[model samples]
Target: MQECLGFYAWQGNWERLFGASFPQTTDQAGVAPLLSRVPVVWFSFDEAGNMTTQNAYANRPKGWEKMVDACRGRGIAVDMTVAYLDGPKLEKILADDSITDRIIAGIEREVALFDGVNIDLEGLGSKSVHQADSRTLVRYNFNRFLNKLRDRLQRLNKRLYVCVHPLNGWFLGYDYREIARLSDGLVVMAYHYGPTPEPYEPVEQSVTLALASGVPQEKLILGILTLKPYEIPETLAEKVGIAQKHRIGGIALWKISFLNEDFQAVLRRLLQIK
Candidate 1:
């Protein structure tokens, strides 16, 4: 089995993630038991690349620090994600040198608590209206920001992971080969594809695009949405299967809260756990 990275989302009002309704999984009692099963946990504690405030400080989940410490103590690689989904704003933020410097410095403070950081900047690339890659300015600024971030993380002995839109999608900002060359790796958010909530064609095409774009198969982590409109157990299982079939780096589940009974059963069977 490849690496299974679970995004532990408890940021802000959980009901509004990606502008969809989901049961508030942050405060659920059942989540305790599932904690031990996760091999790697990506902490999405609500960061928006803000220059005015440290968003993580206000939005972090209760006991999140302890969770990070405990996960690392268990030998699990715990990382954090900072997201900002506005293209215009994100492009502007990246375009400013002093602002980007402050943002990177602020991120360092949060990432020091984990194994690394995942830059979850969306919108910037997805705005090109079904074009090839990100806008040239967006591409240039974003990569430059990554370059500086990569250097900062290197000094802190932390890894940098970037979450990107699927190359097959209309979202444009991602330059996969360029991003792969600049950072440690990438998580392709190939979640909204469907003929039946979780079909396989888009994923196959995405993995194909990333590889053909010169991204190493081993460094590409396939990220998929496991809940919401996921009506059956096979939906989640099939998504994971695509990554395994391609022999990519791993699979990243959108969030862990939806690992309720039905999905847990599916997970156990796929992981071959007793």
Candidate 2:
């Protein structure tokens, strides 16, 4: 079984994944031994890696360059998240044509430093964070934003990948079919199956649903949960095997920052299992 190690660089803490294993200096060569065989995609959280509330992406973080440079030096692929908001602030920003244009321009500017872009516009249709009446507006704005992004990246001949959750009543803002058509690939966030004792959609189930959704299996990247918020007996290796047997384009572990040495070793074993 072959699997790609996905690094979610949340909170500027890539080192957290391996703890002491990460050297004090990212400058050392031949780091990330796990990446030797498979392609790695880095998922930098949008809105400054914050989860409690949506915030505008601020200035580039301090260690951004070293991380990017190190990964590229190792022949790893990288991608960052583009966050969008649907509120008074967003309305104001959109109202100003210059602001919208500048924001898009800024996105293009930032992506130049990496291999691709990952659009992570969460709270699109989630009433828990957004108003119900604004769902349609949010949906429209989200798609329009993606269209503009796709168009811009097309001009540069770059890839645009989207990471979105499974279609739920709470997040109807995203239409997977159209999204799949517009972007180079779709990363179905198969986890976050909240509260269900047995996850509503396990790894195998997510693969089945993704294939049935008209997303070319090869273009669909499975988001495997490296850290479970809840207790689940199965190990990460088991899930990797399931995904490998299904033969997805690849499986992207939800994060690098959350894995321990044991977890990473498991990841390495899984990657070489075939």
Candidate 3:
């Protein structure tokens, strides 16, 4: 299968990006200059309230239709992200069936705007303390929500995708087995490993977990981060290359803003050498 590339960006920056193809407002355009060329784009937005103080793409941006149209002209696919974490509001919403319906309905409406939906439910409730006991509950409820969401998307002939972070205390509540079974494919956010107490290849961790979860290798999409503060030290970089040799599936970068020349070049070399 041909591997895929995806770029994450706020919806508002669409115009500035079009500048790379400046002076040409046509359907085919822009600075798609980067390693592992992205053919799909993922956009995250806050719903119902301002979840993040940082401004996100306004629910929908003007001219996105034209922009997506332009991308589709180049054979690119566009997808949207929906995040639901455990919190007081989530607790209240899940406790009340009617409330959950209303909230999910709203999410479905937002999801309908794109070709598919990517669910990012990391950092929900406390995971460290109840990782073992809460794992099944979290997975069960998550799957329930997806089943409902899937029904809604099916009516619109839309696809569903899931974004999973690498093993982190925050996501200990997640049951990878059930999640992989429910999701169409997994977008493993595998780049945070190298930024911790001891740096390591995030993709390598993802590969191990993905295989352990019994998630089909073809259904796994290795995720990379354009962000920095990373120290590869020659040895680990070579190990990373060996990990990528497995060719599990596609690859996607976290955000476009985090990418720099040096980072991009390293990724290019990895992909080329792989």
Off by over 4 Å in 3: 11-60, 84-96, 194-198, 201-203, 231-243, 267-274
Candidate 1 off by > 4 Å: 11-58, 127-134
Clashing pairs in 3: 86-124
Clashing pairs in 1: 125-172, 125-173, 126-171, 126-172
Writing each residue's lDDT as its tens digit, candidate 3 over 137-221 gives: 6556656766777778788887667777666424554556666776666777665554432245455766777778788777777
Per-model lDDT: 0.67, 0.58, 0.54
CA error at residue 243 for candidate 1, angstroms: 0.8
Best by lDDT: 1
In order of lDDT, best first, we have 1, 2, 3
lDDT of 2 at 129: 61
Candidate 2: 10-residue stretch with minimal lDDT: 44-53
Instruction: Give candidate 2 regions above 4 Å deviation.
Output: 1-5, 16-31, 35-60, 84-100, 127-140, 195-203, 231-233
Clashes of 1: 4
lDDT of 2 at 210: 68
Name the better of 2 and 3 by TM-score. Answer: 3
TM-score for all models, in order of appearance: 0.81, 0.73, 0.73
Q: State the lDDT of candidate 2 residue by residue for 186-253, as single tens digits.
A: 77767666562225346567677667878876677776666755313345666666667777766666
